[model samples]
Target: MSDALVTHQDIALRLAIPLEKAHEPRVNTLIQDSEELIQDAFAEVGRDYRLEVANLLQRRAIIRVIREMVATAVIVGPYSGARSVNSSSGPNSDGLTWDKVPEVSFAGVKLTDAHRRALGLVVGNDFAPSWNFPPATRWPLRGGDN
Candidate 1:
């Protein structure tokens, strides 16, 4: 019942998923499940900038979570052939193979360095201020001008 940080429309647009699928209950559940992680990331931005950080970073985080959920479901779902297999030999070879379920990688679901930078949760190298230097009067000065 609570508001989602990213909408089905947003996910459809960003992830190129069908609108119906993006709006599915399972997708919404995944988004809701990721709320705690998103909130924790937002908390790292500090109180003063929390609003702004959430405004900018929540969509990307939600998209990542949704993608992860879908991937995991697909990898372990019945359609993935994890418990069954088809063989070209004959009916004798058509029995269940009982293949190991693939290990789904969730790296993409976590917040990245770039996301942290955008949210101001992590700072990059600082550049020294040039305010003390006088403005150059000429455009094509030689290297010795300094």
Candidate 2:
């Protein structure tokens, strides 16, 4: 019944968490936070995305994106800011050495360009060929009747 595009059930499925686990208070907060982030992102772009989700297909697409966002946040957890673990090893003389740490981590979920496209928030440019025409008629310039 919440206004969030996705439900706890959806997040649970994505995260492979139990239904009861997904119902945890923190899970609900994560859902709300993800929804707000999406709304704010659209608002920043001067788009009323809520209005655009009127279509059933469009709504589903947005919901899918929101659910994924929440699930990602849950997987990352609040304490840990790691978006991905490149590689890990257990007890070695070499010890644990990170080849590279990402500049940004999934502390919070943000809409990606792919998500925007899937949500129909981004409009593709028309690549059809176009020509500029003179104000005057081309026939007249071609020596036709003025």
Candidate 3:
């Protein structure tokens, strides 16, 4: 009930698990951790978490990789084009723009938010942003409900 964000340590304790449970060779942990992180981020943004969780849970399988690694924020941005390495664009620039996009005011919002924002800017454009966490590290995002 404190007006503060929760940490992964708190969540781990609650599960009677370790902060590294996210890397315990199980897929479900990734999904649950991602879900919890998304929920917590939304809560930070003053969103109705019950509704958001319900919406994301409907497609849980898609986000199942999050437990073992950091879920991306590219999904939260707008798409630009074929999005491949080409002569026209490379290394993070597809020449995208944010027009009518919902502006987010919180930090650590997930990649899904970027996707939604990108869509708001352009209905059919594909946008992706790299959060750039070392893929091999698999740091389970910490803090929520903890």
Candidate 4:
């Protein structure tokens, strides 16, 4: 897509998928979709991605986050609603399970707290003040220390 932040090549290299697979229509579509989701996330935090991440330093950081977001969407595909999957061979056989945390998984391409931080979006404690105020001065013993 014209405004896609990551290209098929980038996705392919990141996921170690065949370049041909990355060029498929599904992957291409996911690339554009992921970027749109990212833009929405930026807007949610009142940050204009194009404006705030234009600097060289910010660009590198934001791009890495964006790429990971897109890769996740592509990897998760359309079946993002399932939080966990369990497979077992038999009653007492080996089993494999995969689990995902909601905050970290967009189910497809959702923005994670880490992503917001990398983009400089405000999250808990990002703006927390650390200054220690001096103890309040006690009033003179007006009541004789009552």
**Against the true structure, whose lDDT is highest?**
4
Candidate closer to the true structure by TM-score (higher is better), 1 or 4:
4
Following a full C-alpha superposition, what root-mean-square deviation does model 2 have from the true structure?
7.5
Q: Model 3 TM-score?
A: 0.26
lDDT of candidate 2 over 1-146, digit per residue (tens): 76656777667766775656635676677677767766776787787876756778977887888777667666644434433444446653333333322221345565666676776665455344577666975543546555
The list of candidate 4 runs beyond 4 A from truth reads 1-3, 17-23, 76-100, 103-107, 129-146
Residue 36 CA displacement from its true place in model 1, Å: 2.5
Looking at model 2, the pairs that clash are: none
How close is every model to the real structure, measured as TM-score? 0.39, 0.58, 0.26, 0.61
Best model number under TM-score: 4
Query: In the order shown, what is each candidate's alpha-carbon RMSD?
Result: 11.1, 7.5, 24.1, 4.5
Per-residue lDDT tens digits for candidate 3, residues 14-128, read: 4433435544333234334455765555566566656543564423422332322232212222232223332354565444433332322123223354543322222234454
Alpha-carbon shift of residue 82 in model 1 (angstroms): 16
Q: Candidate 4: lDDT of 13?
A: 84
Candidate 1 regions with alpha-carbon error over 4 angstroms: 1-3, 17-23, 48-50, 53-108, 123-146
Query: Model 2, which residues run further than 4 Å from truth?
Result: 1-3, 19-23, 78-106, 123-146
What would you estimate as the lDDT of candidate 3?
0.38
**Each model's number of backbone clashes?**
0, 0, 21, 1
The digit string of per-residue lDDT tens for model 4 on 15-88 reads 85455653467566766665676678778867787975577787777668767876776666444555555667
Writing each residue's lDDT as its tens digit, candidate 1 over 1-146 gives: 53555444544455543446534665455455445555676665554334543565655544555455444443343344346657676546554665544432222133434545544455444354646877878778689876
